[model samples]
Target: MTSAASPHLTGGPETLVICGRVDADRAELTPRGELVHGCADILARALAGLPATVARVDLDMAGVHFMDTAGLQFLDVLADHGRRRSLTVTATNWNGQPRRILELAGLDTTDPLTGLAVTDPLAAAPPTAPASSAVALERAECLHVLQEEVEQLRQAIASRPVIDQARGILMATHGCTSDEAWHILRETSQLSNTKLRDVAAAVTASAEADGPPPSPELRTALHRAVARRRRGTGKAT
Candidate 1:
């Protein structure tokens, strides 16, 4: 027997509508509409509604036409939900604007949710080189790029929880939106010449009891980043 949820939106002109069904140990969620602010909470609630028997969750993202940077939080919600329950969560059928958004975010566009690249669309294209050696070299370069991307995806997946935690801390402490928090973190990382994950970890640690705050350099960088955001937007950040 299969159980399904009623189709509904989170209530906005550009909102996400979630509808899905569960069968045995697998739950399939089909989300349509724009993935924007408040979308993550809606996704979290939908995941909570699933039965304990579900060990895997798959999202069909074909209908999802648009996604902003905040959409990453929607993915984070799925990841956090899966991690807490030891479930396998995957979002597939990504294309168009959402896929482009994933690419811009340095995520795996082919399979963003799992951070897995299922296919190499570039490999199928014939090499334009006239010489066999040149073709081989071109292929090798492509292979190298693919390997780099795979490694990046692995690192991104591993760092996601800490980064999300850091973003939440920034949002709460600074009274900023998720997008603003992300920009702050990124700007801090670049300005301080530090890795983004390291910056995130520092932010997370600073919020915890008895945990050390960010170092002087990072602290200065963060302040500058927040200031820049506020000045650029002409609003609180």
Candidate 2:
């Protein structure tokens, strides 16, 4: 059962598709689609804001089971967009009904191991599979989606240890508590238009080099957050 509604998480706002940590140049999107038949427009809208670079877009379609004409058409459209933008759009881990559909549309979604193109659809007939086969495939799709979520959760939690170290460093340097340090991290993330994990990673890296915030940009953003908070409260006694 593919759900278009957002997936509720504990901390922040819910993200429907759980896109892999998108940086400036690349994005990995794993759409949890049981049947990607009629929702091309919704998917397209979700993928619109590509960073102004030749994005290496990797579409992980392991979770999709069924794909109709509309789904294949969307892939073609995405391929065209990639060519126009000099991007490399590749969809991988396709099998069963979805793979058959893509093959008919002339989109080469080949095997994971060999990187060799699977059999030509025109050269051979599509295989006839049983209902149990589909059920098994659906199960596999669910497992793949679950694994994706698990990996995302792991990355989300992995940031905390480093962020804690950064918080301690900030507390010692600025005479602030853990909460105030977190405020600085959140504010810097907001002001610099960067993810909190990235900010934490930078701070950790800086500590390795025996320095403050790794970059001047980070330094500036950190101080700006403190300044803004101070201004709101007036002069501190």
Candidate 3:
């Protein structure tokens, strides 16, 4: 039998969809869509919605074209569920950007739920000696840095569409080139002491008929940015 789970997120409609089919004692799950912020929760719900008779779960991730760091959490959800329910969970058939993301996050691309890097035989070997306090501290710091990088990447991916829209708006309104639009947005963001993505979102939203205008600070900064660009290019503002 096939099953699906749907969950609501704050900002937008759900992007991930989990479809499952059950065999004798195993369930095959295929998740298709962009795995963004709340997708891990959806995966959890999907696992919980599985039939009680399912003793094993295999996820085929080929259809998942895009995934951010939340994909790691999705694997965690499956692993946690499998442990709690005494079920075997294996994820495979990962390809494209999702697979590359898995590699970047240092996960087992073949079967991340097992937390074993199958490609490297030495990774499974026991540690030769306990890590010293200094070494442990360094490792922890490295992990913190890695987490920050992953979060930055995720935010960039999430913000790209809005940023592009903002750039397009500026291009159309001012008859500026795309690079000039980007420069204006960046300058305005810096001048207004705001995030580039936030500035882009404000610019995009203000262009809509019913959307709220940007804050006064953003407006002033944006004006100055455009005026400066006009002066630099020897064009009328």
Point out where model 3 deviates above 4 Å: 4-14, 116-237
Which pairs, if any, clash in model 1?
none
lDDT tens per residue, model 3, 142-209: 45655676678779989999999999999999989999999999999999999999999999999999
Query: Which residues of candidate 1, in runs, are more than 4 Å off?
Result: 1-9, 116-237
Deviation in Å, model 2, residue 223 alpha carbon: 88
Can you give the lDDT of residue 48 in candidate 2?
Answer: 66
Q: What does the lDDT come to for candidate 2?
A: 0.61
Candidate 1 vs candidate 3, lDDT winner = 1
Winner on TM-score between 1 and 3 is 3
Per-residue CA lDDT of model 1 for 1-237, tens digit only, reads: 454544443436657878878888999998889887788888888888888899999999998987665577888888777766878888888888678667756577766765532234464354665666776675456445544655676699899999999999999988889999999999999999999999999999999999998999999999999999888878754
User: What TM-score goes with each of the models?
Assistant: 0.47, 0.37, 0.53
Residues 160-193, model 2: lDDT tens digits? 7988987887778677768878998999999888
- How far does residue 148 in candidate 2 sit from its true spot (Å)? 33
Native RMSD of candidate 2 (Å): 18.5
Q: Using TM-score as the measure, which candidate wins?
A: 3
lDDT of each: 0.80, 0.61, 0.80
